[model samples]
Target chain A: MTLLESRSRTSRSSHGGTAEDSRPGDLCLVVMETPNAPHSEAQAAVSDPPADLSHRLSVLLESIGRGDQAAFAEFYQLTSRRVFGMARRVLIDPELSEDTTQEVFLQVWQNASKFDPKAGSPLSWLMTISHRRAVDRVRSSQSSTDREAKYGASTQDIDHDSVADQVGSRLEAEAVVRCLETLTETQQESVRLAYYGGLTYREVAERLNAAVPTIKSRIRDGLIRLKTCLGVS
Target chain B: MTETNSGRNGRSGSFGDTVAVDLASGRAVDLAELYALDALTDEERQAIEQYMSAAPAAERTEFFDRVRQARETLARTFRIEEQPPADLFDRIVAQLPVQGSGPDAGTPAPPASGHIAGGQFAPRQPASGQPAGAQPAGGDELAQARQRREERRRPGGTRRWLAGVAAAAAIALGGVGVGSYVADQNDPMNQVVRAGDLREASVDVAGGGTATLLISSSEDAAVVKMNGVPAPPAGKVYQMWLIPKDGSAPVSQGLMDEEALSKPAVVEGISSAAALGITVEPAGGSQSPTLPTVAAAPLGA
Candidate 1:
């Protein structure tokens, strides 16, 4: 649809002041390869994006708030893969993941009006909601019981190699994998189990045979190192 | 326990109440990392939320910024993206209410006269006498239900408003309230069912079941009592809507989740609504009434 092309120019000019100040290069590679790789025109906009893409998403959300179905379709096309991917990572069941994906998009449609750019970038807002919904589903009583039964039949150690295999061969994924290597063994395990495994810090501590505070500090320190290495801020 | 240093334990106490207090009091900024990772329980998250709410606005903003950055960075690590099923978008579209056109376009304007018709309330028997079953069999049932609504809304077959003392007398003679629970004075179900000007109507739900609406124009509310209504399809719920007489978008009344099925659900703000409609939606409901309502009853005035 022409929605993306028409809105991108308006949003670019409107967000010029903030766009000029932010670190445009920090997330450029990551954003480029993640969700928008399938669309050729989207790839062209990757050169100076961090704010450009975020502003475009914000504008799409605003359009969706006014019940513009075309804009909603465009937004879904742009972000559904990543949303579904996040749900797959946490829920692991194909059926559940598909259901969660539907729920997340429906939520985006219903709550588009509540989005505030001042709170966070549009991708960040979307990922946060996706992660929360997936995690919530994982923690629900029935699913957790099923997971526990499944886990009891498997090894307790975090499957680091499996995670590595799941990372695509793209530059961003490789970069994150490299940053993850920089953390100590304990930090890597703690962070991986808690984030991708959808386990609480207490559960991470239980799994690792470490004290709760030790697990907490490991996650905090590990994230700080990754944040710096990835140039997130 | 003996392997740890005494100093860390001494500072935070024995890992239960003291640590929770530390988190609630805003002393545990490091917990922001766990919060970002979605690694905290609901109680832990609530404590952090309490701390953030009390902190200065700038400090609060900074905390969220930190969480956002970490979360975004972690999100990038999810490199393998899977395109959702091809039919998923169509299914999502199915859940959105038809807006600004289509079936909603040809409805006549609401009557301008102020007062409602004083005719007797004629309780129509449900078309099918079968009990509400499990989930709806399939889309065929929904299509049939929509056809029934279309027939009812046809120009010449417009539903007439029926109300009178005789109808109120009939309701009074029907001994028990809709639910088995004792009707407390403050109960919403009691308030509407016991109102002086209450009107009642029942519509057979699509798959198999009945939904009865008890309306009180004086209270500007209605209570929906669902009987033998099939559970919504997996991962979905029945959402109620108030269809305005002016043909604008329908306003959502609320959702009837599985647990809510047996009980009477009170729907307020019915004064401007010309009809009540029920649609099966994704859990948590949709912003508008999804087309092809499972059932509908005119709130004629």
Candidate 2:
């Protein structure tokens, strides 16, 4: 189904139609078929950008801000999978993740005019929104359930969640893991429990048998350390 | 003031001193980063958010960037490969408020109801170091500028704006500076502060100081003044709430900064509130007041 859409889209665009007329559905169909297409190919058919993928995304976002539907479609085609994948990992429920992704993109469509290139890279901006929305869904739903129900009795389980193994070996992901490895063991645990486990500092402290203040400081310090390691200015 | 002296303070030697001052000031400079990563408790988040709403743009920006970077780093660690339902993209596009289309082509341009389209506040680097409030250009430029500012006002836009404003406000926040930045003349806040026929209500703070609610004669807006209230302790911030006369949920008015203790903060959208309530909360303002009201005043009285 996607292939037919892509072929029709390619032919349509090639035959005097503006590239902007092609839907993202068509773009992704083509993108998914490209292997070794560089870890960061935001636009296919365009020459591969050398380490300037962030720059391309920023430009595309700027165009989207101007009410360019084509730019938005291109963005959606390139990024929806990664966005959905992030939602899935955090929400841990496929159905909920789908809903969150839908909402996230809806927000993107409604709020694309709000993207500021100077703030950060386009991917980070979108991911930040994706993370926040997914977490909100998790927290609101978790409010009705027992908080202590998810993590078992021992703190040892904090380190053993299979979620960590599921991380892809993309260069950026590898770099993150490398930077994460630089933290002290306790800092690593605190960050993981808070970020991946989606537990608040108080809960992380409870799981680690430490004070809440201590957990807060650990997470803060750990993040600062991670920032420096990641070379984020 | 010499390079040698500056270097020493820049080193880890002065790190302890800096931490002590931040703590003594009751500022959660550290927790601001944690709050961004969703690592803090509700109370902590509220406190930090309150601090941030009034914090210097440089500080807020630094923290926001750190948080964004932290999130981006953590995001890379997610190894899943799930795709959203196929129709999701189409659904999003279908719902978009179509732009530039005729009456039948797309959704009519959202009523230019002056409602901020929001999510636009990606802080631009202000070349003149002017307050962000003053430079909102009129007409098309104004619309673009308003959209930018409104972005920060949107959910999820706060963190994003905090980062943008950091860059935009880097010099501007300093020009407006402590105790006066929020008072930038262009903000609606100024109208309430200078409102004619104002009324007043006061409540004593249990921690220390007094909080006064200054309502405009028309009761459309309010300016809150805090006196002698010490900086909030770690993991906590002072949040203001508006309780409707009809017993509806309290509407959050935003975090009250430490500076507001020494000055006045105009609470937007509170003229109709039956009473005004202040509570200690975790950094970002709460969904509802989490702690008992530390201070309360009847607005109608």
Candidate 3:
């Protein structure tokens, strides 16, 4: 893939359909004779999200603790890109990522109080939220591929060193990577396949032809080593 | 058995080893790993989440330091790799109304006490009105709200959440109805089983050990597609039929599309088709296949 810094301040309108035009209102279009749908279409109308965004989201999320909206919109702007990126990375569909971003934002709006700054930074918390949702989407969207295959891509394609790079262009990033370098080859390999690639510990086991316990141990040891490398006690 | 950990009263189970305070110092394992990868099991993840929730303030900053490192590294990958669609944020920010835009969304003028309790900003009142929010409800409010909900509904009533979902679904569907056709809208199961969520129904075809049916549609015809190795070949093609679970006469849904015989499709009349089956028939498709071989997966969410 070409290297393009994702510095989008705002480009959702370019997706073509304007907010007024994007009402998911018409179910007759998205669903057809599919059975067991609620006998009526009335049950299909999800609440429409409002259309306006120009504030910093961190501010909005802060207000959300007090049940604020402007704060939410601002939070949306600041975080939507990261949220969408995280979802798309996992789900592999821009449209799905967009939808997932919306869902996560709505969730953030509703659960703002749950955000505890003392726990982690707002961005980190948001990343966790998006990550969890994306994982769910990939799991729920399984088609002909068996669950095992569905989960396989998440593992084999992880780009580890870059995660450190994304956080900031600081020495801390280098330090984390440096620590990663300290692990035994097997331990490091296991960690890369699992985290960045999104593979389950079991799939890693099958791919490596090693027993599950060994894989688990390698993961635990790899993480411990990583923790030490990052200078965590 | 996995060890059962009943965390202080009714809290969810946690996964990581509990760190004794002195041992919990930040120099060992990095905190960023908790959110960095998809490798952790659901249980392990939930554990990390719970721990994060309860983690002390000092520990959290150390964790974010690791997350920032991960972000720095993650940033290097891309053609908008993890970039948001341009201006998506600006558009979202623009739509927010001016009032109620602050930390409290500019706090809606608190309503009368009764309505206040129900107000979106009403202080969450636990039990007999222990004010859920001190400014906004505090942790006590959350606990009290849960406690009150438990008292009113029952402890950990998974049903309340489901009921709330059902009620919300009804109100939403009611608003969209052609007139107030709120027939089965009250039915919880109806609320849960959406057409999009419908799972396919299936039965075995002759020598074919297993066949999965992919059911889809147009306003006109219900398309039924089957995928299976198939049983011993009869002289003719296998015909498809709809056997309604309600025990109605078998409706001739239609012949399977030849392309669909290998893949999935746009079928008609499927919502009404209760159970699906396949039978050996003349290439044109029999009014009813000789025998419904395998019943296909159920359709309708």
The candidate maximizing TM-score is 1
Name the 10 consecutive residues with the lowest summed lDDT in model 2 chain B.
B165-174
| Location of the lowest summed lDDT over 10 successive residues in candidate 3 chain B | B165-174
Tally clashing residue pairs in candidate 3: 90
lDDT of 1: 0.59
Alpha-carbon shift of residue B274 in model 2 (angstroms): 55
Give the DockQ (2 decimals) of all models. Answer: 0.14, 0.13, 0.11
Question: For model 1, which pairs clash?
Answer: B119-B163, B132-B228
lDDT of 2 by residue, A32-109 (tens): 455645434524222211124455567667766666554555566557766776675566665677788888877886
Give the C-alpha miss distance for residue B111 in model 1, angstroms: 37
What TM value does model 1 have?
0.50
Computed on C-alpha atoms, the DockQ of candidate 2 is 0.13
Residues B22-49, model 1: lDDT tens digits: 5654445556678899998888898789
TM-score winner, 2 or 3:
2
lDDT (Cα, tens digit) per residue for candidate 2, span B1-301 = 1112111213221112232343345444554556667654555566666777887898787667666676655544443443344335545655667553333223211111112233333222234432232322212343234435544344433322222211111111112212244434466554453344444444455565556455674648776666446787776788888898788999887785554444456665665677788898887668999766776765653
Per-residue lDDT tens digits for candidate 1, residues A57-103, read 89878877756554565567557667776676667665678788888
What's the ranking of the predictions by DockQ, best on top? Answer: 1, 2, 3
